[model samples]
Target: MAIVARGQADRGPPRDRCGDPDLDDARDCRRDRRAVVLPRGVARRRQAVDHRRRVAGRRGADAARRAGDGEPAQGAHPDGRAVRRRERHLLHRDGGQPGHAADHRDRRHPRRDPRRAGHGHPGPARALVGRCRHRGPRGASRMTADDLVWILPLIPAVAALAMLAARGRATLVWLDLLASLGVLTLALVIAGEVPSRPIAAGPLRADSLAIPFLLLIGFLAVATSIYSNGWVRHEVAHGGMKASSLRYYHALVQAFIATMLVTVLADNLGILWTAMEGTTITSAVLVGFHGDRRGLEAAWKYIIVTTIGISFGLFGTILIYAAAAHAHGAISDAMSWSEINTIASRLDPGIVRIGFIFVMVGYGTKAGLAPMHMWLPDAHSQAPTPVSALLSGAS
Candidate 1:
């Protein structure tokens, strides 16, 4: 009975080495309840912590990369406490983490992404940017010595026109005088003793007659340019010419000078005749510049009479060519004045005399000599004073 009691006592309490049976059972129940409840909550919390840690790690890696590359790290979340805690733990384990203040200073503020900032179409701005890049910097205006050289011829022309246009402006008259002086200087330099090359296949000569004519023309042009300024001004003041008519007048004067220069310099009779005809056309326009009935009628008569006379001159040219063909057997020799003059005595003097008659009549009409003087008085009288001066003096 005693052995049986001892065995029963040893197996008596199914407690965990404690003397209280109820307490032991309560403890085991509590443990079992805890085991059932705590595991799921702890597992969920751990998963959240792990996710936060992973995100924090990614952010830290990105920040590190950005810092190394000298670019701003943006878009990191501030409200993620778990991630912050994990980051703190990691930083503390390594060293101290950079402070929020320092990180804020180091990091740039979030900017509007360039891709999302604007509402306009993107293409034009891009094209503008490309053009800006291509053009680089603006450059200064460039002028050279050769450009200055061109101004020599241009100044006289400009001054002559300006003088005519300014009309009553006394200041411009002085300016015109200065421009003429410049032209004289240029002409002196160009008209050196160096002989001009022959234009046609004949001996080249610069006769006293041609040189004197050239010098006279130049001197007369200078005087006329100065005289025109005052004359046009008087005409304008007196209501004889309008501003627009003055412009045509000045332009025609320059054209006349250029044409006459060509005529005097021409070695070939054909070229001389062409230049003279051009002068006639240009001068006729000047004669009619006023557009009045008298001016128009004068221009008409001048043109008709000159054309008829020049037609005879053309016939004479053709006859000369015919005679040259009979003598020299070359058509080109007929066109050269020097060659014709050299062979004039050998050729039929009667035909030569007739040709001279036609030539003299044609050019003389333009030269304002004799019967052609009928149209001249009307044209000159009707034209502005400056134009009249030019017609009478310069021509």
Candidate 2:
């Protein structure tokens, strides 16, 4: 037998540790055919290495085909020491590079019994192997808290639809109460998911600022629904309001509540304004539901005053959108709270100041602040008890 020097090709077929050439090839083929069972931490590394090798091999094969060579140059010396070394490096990254994960199989003792390998810990071993799988950073595709929390606004909007479909006074009353209860329950569930700061999804957001306010709305919505049942009965019994009018009132109140819910959940200032305007339209009818001259006058005042304020808010929103486009280079980015907050310091100071002034004048009127408070008392006093509660508590 001629002994070959290191790095030289052995003058024979590749043999296993037992000196059988067929055994090594057969064992390797079996290992390749069988699924690789490895510890979770090492499995990921092996998968990555395997993927890279497959890609590289595909590229090499394509190049060989393009060059009119069916076989690669490396195929000439498959059993050479250099070829085996390269193959070993390609197949595994276990040569102790600091960045590469070390395989745990090389340890002197098994961490757990080999007999119970595939079957999980039978006697309180705590399943250490499976825990490693989930220990990595969360993937980008994972759903965010905002994705799950948006159902809060939808609950009230659905409630509004049910109110519009109610057949009679009794049905309207029960539907209103049930919808309010549903809104309250959903609000509580969403509030629990919110953290101290705002969590956002597209144009909607929930945070410490919105959650407390939403909780108040939820309570008030349910409370007013319960109270309105008796109030509607009193109005109808005394011939104060027609049955047809009460049904419209029920529908309008729910739409109003849905608008308020959307307003609080809005991440974009534009959405907030739209939802705010929605409240005005829906509640104006409720404000003047009594059909008296005084109620009608109050509702007109509420509409006229709020409309002016809303116009100012609209101008402000447009200016801000322009500024946002100028600052961030996109019209849509201008409407995003995340984008605006990110580049706020870089925005034009003059534009920002004017925009904020309009915003204040517009939203302040809706909030019943200072001079805008004129329509507040008249609208609140003339409106029904439930409508008044909603305007006072939510709007």
Candidate 3:
């Protein structure tokens, strides 16, 4: 794009001034003026070389355009290593581009669940996930966040069963506290591992949205367990609660926590609904554990209202499932949140809209939003202090 002009004013336009030393001097160029007009200060021979290169560039550009964008023309580099490097860069930019993907394949085995990836194959992020796994002791693979997903719901569940089989109040209390501590520990560990790849176990997954809620539940469980021990003892001493109620109370508390944990971790829509129902059941009994008229009334109201609302959620779940089945022919995991989301654009909009409305209302009622929160006030009022905290903070 450089332009050079002759000193004479009569010169029509600027001429190229290529500094090729092999070219004839200005006097020789003047002598050959009859063969071809050579402008002053220009190398006549280099102009021929430049013209030839222009044609080659146009052809090379045509071939390289057949490759990927942002890449140099093919054969632009002399060395084989440089050519390979250019090809690798182009491949990364192309995202494998159908037939061209083999070169970019990861050497490591795939770790991600294909259902979550919208297909039965690793995605561009496969390499990133592999790198995140890093190295473990003696070349053993480190456990990912997904590996611990099943343990979260199990800790409180097992402790609840242990409490039910145990005799003493102190033993049940100890089990309850220990279970809460265990859940908190695991939540912390899993939380640290969560990054670009989400944690997933069959029917269960904890993505970014669920991690904070899970952490809150775990932390609150430990705090409430400590508070419940003294509160339960005081209630019994004051004759406000029966001594026998302590064991049942601790057992129900753990069950309630287990249900909530499951609810938070569930990736399948059906599993989520089931966990919500589990919460309603376990927490309802705990709400009325006092065995009084007011507590009984609150428990009934809470269960009834929540159940009716959840029925809407069930209908919505069914509608969405049917829509997904119709579109994908049931081979896909339509009930799974991840799988459904991957193909969300393909579902019928009208059905999806209506189903999501039902889902919102149902889950919203569970969340205690206005107009659906009629039972919340009474239930929180009648439940024990620790149970009230759970309903307010974790439930």
Candidate 4:
């Protein structure tokens, strides 16, 4: 009589289970079998899935605690400690075999079972998993259009500091050109994103209203910086301007650009007014960089006239703030454009009218409108042509 194995053929000499001698299943015939070895790629994928599952489990527990009122609310999954305890209980029941533990739970609860948590992820956790998957195999960092919006202003601000440090070096011109181009590219990127979607980060925000100004400023910055490079070299070659003066001129131009960017990006009217004044001060120095009598006269006039105008603008900003504070009882809430525009109808009508008129006149003076346009012509004509272009187009 011949003895036959459990899964062996009933009537055969000696056939391998899968007709392959290398396979573990072919080596022995067993009634029940499980795979113990996985391919390298399959093992890696399994590890990643396990990592995601662990992260999802922890996040689910955190969400439960945050959403819970007192006890673990009705249908929510158990927290980490409870899940661990349950896992330990199952481990003990199956004599430390995890596969047997899963089978035991399925047999015990055929309808609904907590042990089935391994089946799939929770809702919020699935969303997080989707984001992780989007990061791709290489695990590169991701950026959104909203991130570029806030980064736009920082480009010129950093450039200003770099230009100031590199004062006497001839590379200042190249630095200025590269910095201005970077700002322009970033601004264009932001402008494209802003029309369909407004991007905001804390106090700085960009929308349809700000798009025109940002594009205007960004273009002017690039154009003016390019023009300044050639103009500076020419002036230095001739006796018109000193080579040492180039440092002061380049530094001030960057500072002026940064201030204008801040002005356009400011979310609050008060901050806008302040940044406008900052542009005035920085550009005034650039206007008088030649240090001639006419340049000096122009810078002085620019300072006096704009200072007086901005004072009125400040007063107007204060009046509006006071009115908004009366309505909301919070200064921060009052200062934001979104908050103020929402409650504009409820604010005092008379105060709003007066404040707006003052703001208009004050900003109009800086804008180089009639009657208040006295300082513009002298500053533009006497300053370098590049500075003139900015004063006319951007400032």
TM-score winner between candidates 2 and 4: 4
- Predicted candidate 3 versus true structure: per-residue lDDT over 1-395, tens digit per residue: 33342334443332346634434455544543434434543655566778999999977866666556565434322211223333445444535442232333332235643333422245645333435444456868766667789988899988888887898878988999999999999998888877667888888888888889989999889999999889988999998799876778898899999999999999888889999989989989988989899999999999999998889888888889988877777745888888888888899999999999998888878878888999998999999999999988754
Ranking by lDDT: 3, 4, 2, 1
User: Considering every candidate listed, which one attains the maximal TM-score?
Assistant: 4
Decreasing TM-score order of the candidates: 4, 3, 2, 1
Q: Given candidate 4, what's the lDDT at residue 250?
A: 81
| TM-score, candidate number 1 | 0.51
> What tens-digit string does per-residue lDDT give for candidate 1 at 1-395?
11111112223334555555666466555544442323555667767899999999989976676557445444233322223333333333424343332233212223323332222212222222222222335785575332332343466567656656575445555665576566555444334432443222222234434555556556766787778877777778888777556555666676676566556656677777787788788878888877789889988988888887777777777767677666766787777777777776678777777877887777777777787667777778776555566567535
CA lDDT, every model vs. true structure: 0.60, 0.74, 0.78, 0.75
For candidate 2, the 10 contiguous residues with the lowest summed lDDT are: 99-108
lDDT of 4 by residue, 244-278 (tens): 66766787888888888878888887778888899
Error of 1 at 367 (Å): 2.7
Per-prediction TM-score to the true structure, in the order listed? 0.51, 0.62, 0.63, 0.65
Best by lDDT: 3
The alpha-carbon lDDT assigned to residue 132 of candidate 1 equals 27
